[model samples]
Target: MSELDDPVGSSLHGPHAALARRVGRTATYPADVATFCAVPADPAPQDWADLARLVGPGGLADLFTAPGTPPPDWTPEFAMPGRQLVAPVPTGDVDPRVVELGRDDDPAMLQLATATRPGPFFARTARLGTFLGVRDGGELLAMAGQRLHPGGWVEISAVCTAERARGQGLAAVLVAAQVARTAADGGRAFLHVVDTNAGARALYARLGFTQRRPVLFRGFRVPG
Candidate 1:
């Protein structure tokens, strides 16, 4: 076995797997505690093989890992180099544009997400955690919210602004608010971004989010 195949991806496993086991409702192949089937982070060779089989060839599976290197077999359609950034809660009031988003806001959220393509926003994705958004008049224009909860870390995900809403600083405010929320909880705020999105990476840096480590956003094919 190659060194890359060693059982190394463990940051999001162990106790964190319990979250996927408990709330990864979309999980299919194995919903049991020992083998949740949403997205596997840093899986072992046997476990990785099992998940790939579960996804099937030509199908897709997402894997998140702390950056170093990856095995050749687990190729992704898109690979994003991610950073786990933490910030201090704002010393002043949170951005008022950041509005609390809940289940009732699903219609607008889904619509905006579909147009912006900020990763997967499932029908029941609002159940993940607290989500916030900014609306123009009545239309949802910008949004950001939580995704994964590994240990005390809450991932801020689905951050996007409508094309028409760009340059109004909506995305920045929304992200800052989310980080503030996460910080208030005594947990750190983290996010995954495509390495190619230098603009977004720069914005995160301006917000005092220092790079903790590199993580990979992988998408693999599951055969039909």
Candidate 2:
């Protein structure tokens, strides 16, 4: 429960430790790597200060559902109601069409993510974990991959399908592949979706993912 309670923090302290930038107990990834910042579950004032220092003045503190309020000087950025979904161990083989992405694919990956606005992606994001994609010849049609690794759970993130590829079940195929990979790695699968995205929620439900808990996707601008 604690891991899920502070997913970004737990991930910074765990599998993604190498990518973390720390100042006291607060931590975050490099801006290009991710905008996520992690504060302790019951964050104190000093923890906020530590986070401010880590992200620097005027930077975004994208605390991905960590608990605590930023000080008065920190301006609110955006807050969206979201929910976490967990999936049972998958039961099928990855589709042969699914391909593992690598460094050489950075440009195409970034292009596809930018066009689809899946989430925060950067040149090095693929380093976070395994990313699987479906391509139609030279163009990437859809993709999904591992993001946060909190405790024994893996967060499937950045799922998106090109407009031309929509309605072809590419998103479902990629998600299924990610879930199967999560199970193969001895981990559980989970994800977060904004409450307004009814379509995505329904899709996840159809894929056997159940709502685990409600979450708030929040961010703040560090005081200058």
Best of the candidates, TM-score:
2
**Poorest 10 consecutive residues by lDDT, candidate 2:** 1-10
lDDT tens string, model 1, 1-224? 21122112222343244344322212321222112134333445555455555555665555444222224655557766655555555555688778998777988887887898877676656556789999878888999988666566777878889999898889889988888888788877777677777877887887777766565666655444
Question: Candidate 2 regions off by >4 Å?
Answer: none
Clashes of 2: 0
RMSD of each: 5.9, 1.1
Q: Provide the lDDT at 223 for model 1.
A: 41
Error of 2 at 181 (Å): 0.7
- The lowest-lDDT stretch of 10 consecutive residues in candidate 1 is 2-11
Alpha-carbon local distance difference test for all models: 0.63, 0.88
What TM-score fits each model? 0.74, 0.97
For model 1 the TM-score comes to 0.74
